[model samples]
Target: MSTLTAVNPLTTLERRALQSISTSDGNMLIVAADQRNSMKAVIKDAPNGSDAITREELIEVKADLVRHLANHGPAILLDPEVAVPYVVDEGVIARDTALVVGLDASGAETVDGLKYTRFVPGVTPRTVRDLGGGVAKMLYYTRPDRQGTDSRIFAEMRDLIAECNAEGVLLIVELLTYQLEGESDEDYAAAFAGLVADGAALAVRAGAKILKLQYPGSAEASAAVTEAAQGVPWAVLSAGVDHETFIGQVATAVANGASGAMAGRSLWKDSLSYDATLREELLTGRALPRLRELADAVDGRRG
Candidate 1:
């Protein structure tokens, strides 16, 4: 077991989720399709550029992706609103695949010039557990140089941690960065590495057991982020970067101590333009292969 697994120790629920998600080598290949508005945007802007889709089409597309992706032994992150319930009801998710549910309703736009994520008003840890989710996920906006925790964000995370603990489920906290108003792109760029490292450290300090963090820019930087984590198991998020770029990022992260990856867009974005059959083919052909390659990369580092 890893130091975090030993020190914190997994509850039965947490262990079940972890076991379902992790390969025998204890590395993971997590397919994150839990996007909300971002997913809609992909569909809207698909190749033809003007295709109209019904609610059913959106739900089906997500559901199919979940089903197909799960077959490759990857844990899937799905939105509770449409994807999770549908797949669970239809028995589409494989029994051995871990199911993680998104607990936030998020958009691509910033709120008051700051980017952040909040719990969807009605969703709770218990509700997600009841919906067959083994893990509940939430994303938080953070910056590298920030002093103290944003009181509201801290309070929200604390409550969420407590709830998930009580409900016997795992929590995966994702930390992200957005440029604040008046900050130059150059300034944010300079701080990007610090943001990835320090932001992850902050989340770990906030009691996050499983962290989803950005790649911290390079292998050397990733090592710094890992050290700051102090042995907490963390995975890198793809952040909508292109596939080849993300593949390199994942390899670098794992080599530098990241446990695995929790990525979305890079895996399936290209397939959005195709029909259902072609989409599934693309998922199996393109996405699954990439996930397996990443999984192998993670396991290689483990060895």
Candidate 2:
């Protein structure tokens, strides 16, 4: 991580957008329900897989998630496809809770086992603002250890950053690292922290203002990410880990310097079900507590 300074001060609109998605104390607790294909896969793999689930069913799931979880956090991440216009128009999300729309496509294309990101057609920072969203999120795959692995993606990211700045919307650049082809599991695990730290630095250099990063594997690595961010606020993503594991990660991360968390599956994976009544029970009984716990973890360490 370098000690370089930010390129410029945030625009007034950008500053307000950032405030809209954070607590009064300035910590961020974002509930991410923006998954598309992954959520569909979860629904399809259920025992009942009797019929192909329709888009309405997926929207219902997303609505249920937003209905149950959005108010508990400062912000919620929803995709433009099923969740955004529907959730916003229907008022499923609370008025006070900020909305973050994901701009990336559901799943990435793979070439030689390396994943590449694709954006949803016609979605941009301006599109997010037009949707009444305060934040726009873009997820990209990277391998920081290998130079030029994602140069094209990096270029796109730079362009998006410029667009977001011009549009006066806050952009949260999310970095996801994958195990490369022919890499051993052990080696991948060993290199996880470095990859995350380097990836964050790379994003920051690309002019990312806010970051949603994978848990960097240790307290030391977490601190490195904060250092790499150079005072730009960053929140650790849950990455589908269980609630208990994610709680520990949030604790270590915020204690070191993370602003908060942006989590999805970890907070509500088991709560999802086709049975509406049962889903409510699990979301209320299991997921809500996890959200509160994670929020407490972040708030407790607030500076």
Candidate 3:
């Protein structure tokens, strides 16, 4: 199947960013840890965790993830609030490691099982570049059904895409779906494919260079999403699923034409139960092996 040509030719910087994030073989294995308010919530609920954490602690935790994990080769995604600043200033990011800065805000509220996301002001592609970010990433929720439409979000995405293109920065757009009111589990299951495909199509049309998306149930459904992506590089997000399930999804997504994965929680969320030292140990011991498995999966597909 033929893929669509990029709306704008990839700039040298964009190409460099893509290469830095991917393996030497050009297979992506980006590890997304850029959760803001959500991270706080996770930390709060973690076993032996705190209800409230200092900004310093947050930075330490995120920095630890980069220190231990990002060095392993997968590109790292970080939030602008504390993680990005800490990583860049402290030189936690290695020269070869790809650095992605999160541009979205932290106020995603659930309305009847559906999520409504709003963009936070202040972080732009230019700011991301200035902060030494190789790629600027934004995560937003969308649905195939019109009832989930947010014109403001779409408009923001368009502007961000234009800005990234003009500024020579790579943009990674993450498309997630939510359950709407009166929608049963069966209804959601039925609409999953169209939602994933439609969301990818919309992001590509808005000029996303790379898309971070949910798995569309099966390889066949994922193929339709790949078809809709029109040649733009797309990766599967973990969505907090267990490591095994996510690994399978990554393999399936790549077999069906996805480039690779931009996953978060599934990779390291399990390691959140211990103190700093033990946390790092569990993350390094447990998470690294999982990533290695994923990398192998991607490599197999590329082969």
Candidate 4:
């Protein structure tokens, strides 16, 4: 647990929602299946997969993940387009697992080399609550190194936060930084940590109570993010790194004051397949073990 004090008190419902999605010890281990375009790319690249990925196929993949992994975590993050409602209605998710619905659209629009976030139409905090989701997640792309780049998005986020507060839904604001066109990879890597910390600070200033952020380069940077959060309970996102790498990142982040982890591809990417039997085997043998390792990392039980 972080020693930093919370700046704002959580509302009754917000506190309940947070508790519902977290372990008894107050750490969160959230499995993320909210991906859309990236998931389609995976499906398309599968050995037996066709060029055209169907909605049913996507739902099946998500269902398999939920059936196999939901029981191992306190919450699962799903998107409104495919996973939401379907997973809940089918009862594939574990009864004890809480649902978090992603409000962002499938992909972002790149304008002048910067990515802009878009929300799924009609997917708001109230609608998420109506859909039986205990929390709402909104992913926003930011360029903290570039001044004034995220002013509009921050304004929109403030409105969303107010709406969530009014509806009594806890919102987890997820921040992702992107490299601009023509920027050198080395420069981007060097600035990555500060960008994440600055982005977290910006979100906190915009009234974010909870956050999901990318790995901030190193342990010291992770501590910087914790400081920027001001006790808002930030979690580290996997960013599609390999499972082993993600585990190390999670371990470092948690040790440096991250609340826990929110991961998707790092846990289940290789387990995806068209063959049901093979998929099950891979999920059980590969993904489940990875999930356990991640959970252990979150709880500080890993050797």
Candidate of highest TM-score = 4
TM-score of each: 0.90, 0.92, 0.90, 0.94
Worst 10 residues of 3 by lDDT: 1-10
Q: Per-residue lDDT for 152-193 in model 2, tens only?
A: 767877889999888878899999998998999999999998
- In order, the Cα lDDT scores of the candidates are 0.76, 0.83, 0.78, 0.85
Candidate 1 similarity to native, TM-score: 0.90
If the candidates were sorted by their TM-score against the true structure, best first, what order would they fall in? 4, 2, 1, 3
What ranking emerges by lDDT with the best candidate at the front? 4, 2, 3, 1
Residue 35 C-alpha lDDT in model 2: 89
Candidate 4 error regions (>4 Å) = 1-3, 44-50, 147-150
Alpha-carbon error at 287 in model 4, in Å? 0.6
lDDT accuracy of residue 297 in candidate 2: 80
Model 2 misplaced stretches (Cα beyond 4 Å): 1-8, 44-51, 111-113, 148-150, 301-303
Candidate of highest lDDT: 4
Better-scoring candidate (TM-score), 3 or 4: 4
- Model 1 spans > 4 angstroms off: 1-9, 44-51, 108-113, 301-303
Cα lDDT over the full model 2? 0.83
Pairs of residues at least 3 apart in sequence or in different chains that clash in candidate 3: 4-230
* Comparing 1 and 4 on TM-score, the stronger one: 4
Error of 3 at 149 (Å): 10
